[model samples]
Target chain A: MSRPAGKSKLVRGAQGDWEVVIGMEIHAQVTSKAKLFSGASTEFGGAPNSQVSLVDAAMPGMLPVINAHCVAQAVRTGLGLKAKVNKKSVFDRKNYFYPDLPQGYQISQYQAPVVGEGKVLVDLPDGEIEVGIERLHLEQDAGKSLHEQHPTMSLVDLNRAGVALMEIVSKPDLRSAEEAKAYVTKLRTILRYLGTSDADMEKGNLRADVNVSVRKPGAPLNTRCEIKNVNSIRFIGQAIESEARRQIAILEDGGKIEQETRLFDPAKGETRSMRTKEEAHDYRYFPDPDLLPLELDDAFIASIAASLPELPDEKKARFVKEYGLSAYDAGVLVAERETADYFEQAAKGRDAKAAANFVINELFGRLNKAGIGIERSPVAAEQVGTILALVAEGTISGKIAKDLFEIVWEEGGDPRAIVEGRGLRQVTDTGALEQVIDEIVAKNPDKTAQAKAKPAVLGWFVGQVMRATAGKANPQVVNELLKKKLGV
Target chain B: MSVDAATVRRIAHLARIAVEEGEVEKLKGELNAILGFVEQLKEVNVEGVEPMTSVTPMQLKMRADKVTDGGDAAAVLANAPQTEEGFFLVPKVVE
Candidate 1:
């Protein structure tokens, strides 16, 4: 149940059923301060060329040196993915021409990469699926090219040029859009947990290239089209669906699928061909003459391995085992690093399930409604813990806890102090609750007689009593007192 | 192992080199000679040797992850063919 499987069924098309196969090549910017080869800053949104170094600009006679921190970050990420760290890997030059690539070629790993085969356990709604990783490599990123900024000219920004990027490639194990989405999502979560990359799709720190191909069910893989640079997970899903349908249409129409790179037009919900003037698809990769093969010893691998943090998979398991939360709740909470930390802080010394419920159902729901992330959540974890404490100790009824939460969300205050200052505590005193219940029972004599006949009618009286008490009456006490008064 | 006339033109085009129609035949002969000479080096029988990417045995040097070199837009773009507002301007290239 927790293993990787292809869940995508064959799509029934005009002629027959077709299967969609997808693989991903994710380019994640390394969470580092400088470029891969120079001291240039890797900060986002800097002034154009401000972060560019002479080496990054590719001035004549300039050389590139590896950034040790970036290498360590990549190795850490590979270890987190359970990938094998290659003892020696060579840097190769992928030659091409583009205005953004002033160097006329990009430094990439072709013949050998730093990391080898591994598997990432992706959690889907149905179950956990493992996505096979092909390899992870280190490369330098090209600069940004803005084409629409000028009518007849383009502008280039080299701030991102020469920045370190981990090209994590996945085996063609995906079978559906949902699986692709889950794979990218789980990969992003793992990256965030490892602290290798910020993994923010919106910030362009993480991008994915999706490969989509369709064939008759269970047939050998067919011609696959590469969709370049789909940024968001939703777009990845859309791209796969559109590309699969297009290929199926082509195959049904007896037209061969062209193996070429295409782009996903998100606004139009379709993919268009990137028709470029080129002679065969040739990148002419060769070993970079300037850099030597990277060699990592056992000590180096062990050091990075020791520094590894508990990733999402282990964290989810620990959450379920330690906090006794539902597997679903643990999965949800541990999907992101901060949410898990938030849950741990809020669940400390409290009813763990109760805390999990409120954190997931109440707090997360509110955060989603407010369109905010847990990092920016206004409600503090400690406040949540305090609220749960209040509910657990019967200091406030469950209904009053919501009001308390809203009050804290809208305006900050101490939960205990707010309960005291606003007189919002549950009416747990037996005399007061009984008095309220007696009044309710007296007002509804017919209903009270009915309650005597059917004990279930006691619920109506409880609701009436709670409504009369402004939802602050302890429901447990109210139920007990009402049952006694009804003599049922 | 050998270069043809068409292959010479294609190689010249890929390298963005401007070669004349009359020069293609000469360039092809020269390229084939170079390949033939390189092929002769393959005759060496020594097998227990290591492939080297560099002339030295020093490991690849790595620098600290620090912002110690940038922040000079003018110097960075000093040799650009065109510039505006700290960005390099070129003929529009769209994908």
Candidate 2:
């Protein structure tokens, strides 16, 4: 990981420039069928309290049991992050009181999390930045307290209360919001690729708690304020920017910054103080008595490592090396798993550069306009591959290939059938092109004379020949024949 | 690790327990006695021993990932103090 030296991302304050430091604690719900400690279903959008189990609701005499699949998923995630998997980790009780938390104490990992230190490589325009992972802990999620359902009473939804969440904490290595967003995006991609978490922010499966603090250049770490539960990537960046500015304003006015928790109001584009340091809860954390320490053998870790799929970074490098693609194009194509797979299947035994160009430039551009993901693309990889083979074989001109692409996109069918049905193949025969060039040369004697004077004027005759052939003429043949007939 | 009256009051407030003024001294004494008993373990000087979280020395019980329960909303909400429209009604929690 290379950091561009001496490039300071600082906020200009009333006094001087201040550098803002950012770290994120992202909570991604693990992909599983049941809750972490209970056998209740973990489906989303269930009726209020419908998914609550006896253990989840804190009923009397209900002892919590750890879900084996959730543990395996967390271990797989830890390996994917290149983090240390602790053999002996304990579950601790984080005591607190809220309507959402029925147990009055959340079962979480405190001193001994399952995953130890790790690192994520975030790709930026300048270079790569490595964000250090502090730890990854397994914890149960709290229920939802709906305040709007009633005028004076809150409704509690326990569907998500006992769901398992993996809290991935990053070191304060990010200096800008762009780096922060990239970090989250890369992390989410890795999780999705691992099949550990879906990481859908819209469904509340993923959320970020952003920590923002500002300090002068080369100064010690200052007091940091945590912006809690920022759901979207766009809003995470906005929250960091606004929180850093708020801290800088305070420090510039000779006021000491206090460490506290704040909330980001997306509507106002500002962060307001939710709780001060004085009101901060002292969560008396102690190991839970009901559960024993998790012990994993070497075989378990090895199995998980063997089961890991090829990650984005590895796939991008392979694409660059195997297909001889540019680094930028490879990065773009390999950013999403489905897109990369699509490109690999399309580029097989065909013109790799042409396949890459079609996928990146034409297909991506149309997909963007239509607001559809590559998974829902109208054009299949096999169809695109066939079209590229046609272009490579010289059966269709590049212009004809574009028209064919449109036909295949709007009206899905075999590319060969469409090309045969529409008679869109290129006219590469010199005899056919010669007659058209002759007609154009006779019609435009003045342009022909200009072409004879300056060879650059040959483009005019080629344009006329192409127009006469309805853009189906081979452009290279048209240029050659036009120059021969016009005596350029 | 010492528990005083003021500390007991603060803890009660943090836990949202309604501790009366007359009960503060008794609660503090009771908490201090509990802590006093726990402190005796520190004198044993078990320097090389691991800190134990559970009484039983075994791995945590793992369950297969299956949704074997849930979907009975009425039975799940049967014990709620107040129910309205299949939801547990509590005091409005303002964030």
Candidate 3:
């Protein structure tokens, strides 16, 4: 596999040769029924303000009750990334004033987070890549600012306010746009597989703040620029590429890249400076007066770890070794948690290779074309299993099995029943096939002479017999009978 | 633990506050008071304690290597402060 070219350029600076150091801070929403500190539904697409609770809306007298499920999900997410699960964590008040933030300060893990020191294995075309996960911290999300609906005044919707978010931070490890995109993709996959967070970038469930810098090869790191609130994976790559190139051009033109927070304009395909980056003290982060320090036992951490499901990498490896699938196929199947589950369920008690082909090539292709998910697929696991069973039992040819799948997809009937009802079962009776071949050979003596001269032309006779049998004749048996009849 | 006036002004500016010069001293005093309370964390013996990242310990979740719907440019830019012909508009700073 080839590595993607570096987006930033090496240049001579006032401080001498410089190198780029990149890190990322990703905010992923926790998958749970309630908000971080309230019993309100965390479901998206609710009526504005309907999801907000007293705690979520920052009511003065209402106290926050931490959702245990959200915490469990955060811990599960840490374990999935192979991070250290800290038994004790603290929620601190990050003081800031914004119309979108109903609470004067955000309740976020500051000095301490629940998980630490993990690594994500990103699969690059060159080889397997490992991106260091610095920490996975939890915090409540702020509300949204609706600026367009009202021209003079901005309206705030607290629906997302107080919802739990896990800010997974990474070390300065990624080198190119492709790697950055792969890292986010892999992180989302792990989060989904753990069932901790939905990791939906579009729903505002997951977003990445990309940190990029430029320098000379193998030199000390240079001042970095952070692109904020990039919500899509493609934009993440585009931002990194354009930001790095912009920095390179600036340096090449004898200018310095400022340490600032920037925003990616996907339309313009460039990153614009937002503001100078602020340090921690700027937020006036301090322990919250309302919440107490969270304390847990070692056994509690161990229990959360024990409950984690098989992650993507582990499932991918198992798919390859157990099911005889290619590494690429395994990667595709295990990319989504639900798709992996669907494949495993479909492959049960069937030829693994055939089942994998059907799932990846036929089923996934159809789902992609129809813009549906594997979970919402019209074809069920048992239905696919039945189709495979028919092919296995020699009741239908592989070509016919595809047609059967379409029938099952559209008409919604049993696979075996459809094959039987349509009389599409393969004609395995060698005697009947021989009789047909004998008739064809006698009827077309000239063709039989030509076939004897060119034995490869026997395929024409096989096709004729298949057409004669309405494509119900087994292809292998037809070929065999044609060969024996023509004596070639 | 008293925060200096200069440090307070810098912090305020970094945080995007348009604070008046005379108000810096009062803000400094209040920040010092807050910092003094947070200093209590230094007293706890956390020598062997790992830094926590989340409230409940968990791992990162994984998603599939497939593309979701992100091609709609008009829908994405619809919420921007100012936009022109499918592009976000910002004040021109460069000549």
Candidate 4:
């Protein structure tokens, strides 16, 4: 993928002008039933220490047993990103000392990562941008260190320890805050569609370590600062903008930007330096002596590729070309795999454009307001199909169909039955509609005279007639009758 | 593959290590030996070979996104080197 052309001078320091260089390392938790090395349930919300297994807790003499399912998920995720999946990979010990990290070092991928060289297409307001994927490596997450519960003593939760994490590194291709946010969003959508990870930022299931630096346009990249573990998309954008401006300001003055690791203060919307940046050797990374190199064959890689589902980009393109959906509509439907599936099933054997409109505007709008996912929608795909069927057969007008949708959402009944039971069926009888229009025109003679003189005033008469019949009157019949009665 | 003394010192500084000047020569030799071993990897025809990131080619396990109680603040702060008002306290840098 081509990188965005650099424009606008971002130079901040006194000696020379500069441009901002940005890259990201995102760690996403894999969606699996058990921990990476143990059969301990990967269920969240258990009491502290309840979810910990012997291996997870790093009990004496407990050897790590690699979970096969976690491996498959990693392969699936790599394939979903269109990355090269290495048949064989190795685990190394990334030595570091922190309260949350047990065993004094984390077992992670180093020199040999399982996946390599992929691209993610980020949809911006202007157009779609493809960001290059440097690599996606697997590692185990450390436990949480709780510092807020007590005034004097700190506690640790081992629940997250030994959980699998895929550290996806991206090339320094992003230029603006919007692009960075879009990149993460698109990556999350892809991961979710692959069924490999939940990519939930709230639960720390997905987090980003942003690398930011500022330099003159076309100048050598500045020493970048690493912002660690930003968990929200909004914060990711804020951090990039604030940090870039901060660098620009510092350079505009006489000071130099320091290379360090920083943390984003979401409340303040600023990035504060945590510590000086550490090089690869700082962690003293070495091949883990306890574990052996993993080796696989072509057959394994082929099987993983075969099991791969349609990715987000592929589905979006299909929706555009095959279903005749607008880019925006296609994007909305394909953002979530389940939502896309719901739309496809609802649109089956129906007017594709109409189905797209109903699914995107009406159904999705209602679902968003109700705070429900497509999977948990009260209006099932089959029910939507039924509703669209009714509309297609002209049994109910579009206006009445919307009313029936509300009834279906609340009562969870058949669309046809709801329309019949509530007597909300469209009044297609031209005579009845004409009679209602005549009565409305007779009651408002002055308005009818004005409408006859000005043809645009026909909507007023149509509204009055529809209101009299409680919106059940067929709109086409009412319009025709109103035009005839007014004699424009 | 041999790392020079200056390169060793630079790496140490990058890693935030307060290495004594006298030890730079010794560390340089050690680093050189390590890099020599790593250089052997280049000899193998890995033109089409992909880099490995993890053993067993597995993903890290994840949990459902719902937020649960991260547990009591007091319990978490117990391990802090210093604390005040239920938050970790580093040396105050500003007034």
Candidate 5:
């Protein structure tokens, strides 16, 4: 079979080019105080079983009661995704037996999910692309089974059991690993902005099950293998690349791909078969006998929509329009909710593009090196605002602002106070600057005469004056002073 | 499809129930009988009735979002078959 016309070029293989189709099922823990169906705490790092309630532990005759706030959070997330919130959705029992699952069956949505189709706009290097979300369902988490805790026995931690989770399934729309990574990054940003979940992959709050398959270009879709529970974004890309190569090898050798579940071994950088479809559980899914259908009112959906904070995309657009920032700068500032808030606070009623330069170029670069988040920034937003104000008012040179930033970073203090204490103010006084320029004019008569003749040489005198005054001279004032002294 | 010996064995294994070789025949018969009984529900002529997940005509009971339970380690560990250092112990699960 030949490759499809108008489709992107497929990955080159030994025999021919092969197309890879990728989909992701992301499980993000809902930001809530208690479990989905119990009063137990959903806080991480709790002692084993200490956070478990009777319902979570599956005590006989203990019934599960849904957390109202968790349901609302799920609705909020659906709205954030621009998904359809199903007014009526049913919970089913997915029958499986695992040591971590105290109940033999997990309470999940099988047929009717809470949220319907939606599309995510992934910002790629070329441009923006849309990834379709098939459905999002509410489910309960299983507890942790730790085998490393004991030599001959496993230990169970029930703290995470029954916690609310949203399983977001995507269509097979991703064309490459880079697109997959961008899709996840955009989804995480949206979720964090909605305040529905922290979506911290490091904290185990968000993880993805990646499904990978490869086909002869323009051929029918091939059987897929799911790479299970890849938590980190880097590993997701690695998993896809390795799994695609594996599938291509199998297909080139005239072997059909088997449907299976595989584990991505990060250390080995390969995918190993965890289980084949023949060994998979039937998971006889049926409506849960305990819980009734979840029916949401239009008013409820509207209330959640009304309460949502401005999401990343909207905030980015506003930053570009109102702040006159570059698309790249707006994207960087709005990537995180905290960073966007910080930028808005610092840029409020001021020169926004200048403020953006400081926040994006200076603050973000420092934060990345120091391994800290914008929330843990050494300089406060108000403090940076003060520094930007000083620059705007010409009270301090840009070079002096850098020195002032270094001072505030090391020793916390008011920006104005630090500038005043260290005598870092700009030499905007044209009289004092003119004296310095006059002396330079006498010493470099030849270069001064050349500067008067060829206006480009004026740059050389500007550097000389700046070096003499230690870069504290206001650049515009220095230019005016040099023009007057050189009689250019 | 009718229940068979291999299907019965597989179901038993999935449920983690110990079904001996001698009991497989008996268990298959019992499961087939249950299936036959449930198959009769297809004969009901009600076309427009909504499928019911619960017997009661009520919505799910929702509780306020709060951590009002837990914190009693001893009470939680009381039902465990074995425990050490405040964790429930079981056979090692390598995967």
Candidate 6:
């Protein structure tokens, strides 16, 4: 068995090619101030039990009341995914035994999820492809268990318990690991735009359980392995690559794949099958008796849709049309909402093409090297706009702009103020430039004679004038002055 | 539609209840009797009505997104059988 036919990401086997089917269930923490069913704070990095309420601890006779903001966040996420929002959704109890989960059952949606089918347009290296979203349901996260704290006892932190999570399930539409990565990227961008979730993978807000399976070309999807503990996007791709190959090896050896969950070990770069459960999965799902069914009206959903921010796809298209940016550059700029906002702020009332170059090639490049996010940049977006305006207005040359950017990045001062204080303005004066050209021509007569024959040699004279003035002379003015003086 | 001995034991096992071999038959009878009473609800003709998620005639009451409670770790972990440093301590169950 190999991968799928899409983008020709087929896995080669000993006998023939196989297709790998990939789906994802992303668990994104809902950006809320309180837990789903309690008034406990949802702030990260609080004391272990400081943020947990009695309802979260599953105290006796404690009833669960839903948090309105969490439900709105879930709706906002579904709307951003361009999915159908079910007017009515029920919360069911998923019964299981776990020390981390104080309640024997988890309050989750099983049959009827809040969000229905949706589609995400993933921008792959080859081309753009659409991945179908199966469903997105709201659930509570379990507590964190630390076993290294004690030798024979595990310490459980309930701070994260009862925190709301939107499990966005994707269809088996990704054929390659690249597609998987792009899908997550696009989804995260949309979530950030909606302000529904922080979508930070390192913070455990955005986690994924990737389902990988391999089959023959055009054949039915075979047994798939659900890989959990994938905390980062890089690990998501590696898990898929190794899991696909593992399935291929098994099928080639005439062994049928077992449908079970596995854990990805990034340190080892392989997937390990989880220990078999002592008992079978019997989640006796039923409606939660503590809470009533969630019923949403048309106006509520319409209001959310109306207030929804512009997503990555629409922003990228606008950047291409309005800013005259290349599709690839637009994709990169619009991948993050903050970056896109910065681009607009920098490009406004300036040379947009030059702004794109400055932002993508210069500002972003420097930011990447500094290992800081745009929000933490020393140079503000308005300051960048000032530097670009200086270049466009001939106040400073492009070379001087680099120096100005470096000064601003290091010292955190106004770009215009730094340029003026440092006297980095361009020398467009024709008289001074002519005098400088005369000195260069008088010094290099032999070279001047050669330049008379080949006007292409005028670039050499322009360089000499720029250097004499410490790279402050305007090249266009110097070029014309040199031609008239050299008679070439 | 009916509960078998195996089904009864499976339910008991999932609920983390220890049932003897002889108790399986007795539990099956009890489960069947309870299911019989619930099965009679199927005799009523109630089409087009949505499944009742709650007996009360009201939508789910949702609280505002505010930190109105919590911050007393002592009270939160008071009932725990074993706790240390404001964390509930349980037998190590590593996965």
Please rank every candidate by TM-score, starting with the best.
1, 2, 6, 5, 4, 3
Off by over 4 Å in 1: A1-9, A449-455, B43-49
Error of 2 at A213 (Å): 0.7
Q: Give the residue spans of candidate 6 off by over 4 A.
A: A1-4, A277-280, A434-465, A481-488, B36-40, B43-45, B54-56
RMSD of each: 2.1, 2.1, 8.5, 6.5, 2.7, 2.5
The superposed Cα distance between candidate 3 and the true structure at residue A83, in angstroms, equals 1.0
Candidate 5 segments whose C-alpha is farther than 4 A from its true place: A1-10, A276-278, A441-457, A481-488, B54-56
Q: Give the C-alpha miss distance for residue A454 in model 4, angstroms.
A: 3.3
Clashing pairs in 2: none
True contacts kept of 5: 0.81
Candidate 2 Cα outliers beyond 4 Å, as residue runs: A1-8, A276-278, A442-461, A483-488, B53-56
Candidate 5 docks at the CAPRI level of medium
Residue pairs whose backbone atoms clash in candidate 5: none
The native-contact fractions of the candidates, in order shown, are 0.88, 0.84, 0.01, 0.01, 0.81, 0.93
lDDT: worst 10-residue window of model 1 chain B: B49-58
Q: Candidate 6's residue-wise lDDT over B34-79, tens digit each?
A: 9998899889989998876656587778899998889999998888
Q: What is the C-alpha lDDT of each candidate?
A: 0.90, 0.89, 0.79, 0.80, 0.89, 0.90
DockQ-derived CAPRI band for the predicted complex in model 6: high
Model 5's DockQ score: 0.75
DockQ ranking, best first: 1, 6, 2, 5, 4, 3
User: What's the TM-score of every candidate structure?
Assistant: 0.96, 0.95, 0.80, 0.82, 0.93, 0.94
Candidate 4 residue lDDT tens string, A249-290? 887777898778889999999988775444443677887766
Q: A-chain TM-score per prediction?
A: 0.96, 0.95, 0.88, 0.92, 0.94, 0.94
Tens-digit per-residue lDDT, A233-330, candidate 5: 99999999999999999888889898989999999999998864458658989988788889998999999889989988888898999889988889
lDDT of each residue in A249-322, candidate 6, tens digit only: 99999999988889999999999988676554678999888878889999999998999999999999999999
The parts of candidate 3 lying over 4 Å away from their true place are A1-22, A59-63, A276-281, A431-468, A483-488, B1-95
Number of the top TM-score candidate = 1
lDDT for residue A179 in candidate 3, whole number 0-100:
80
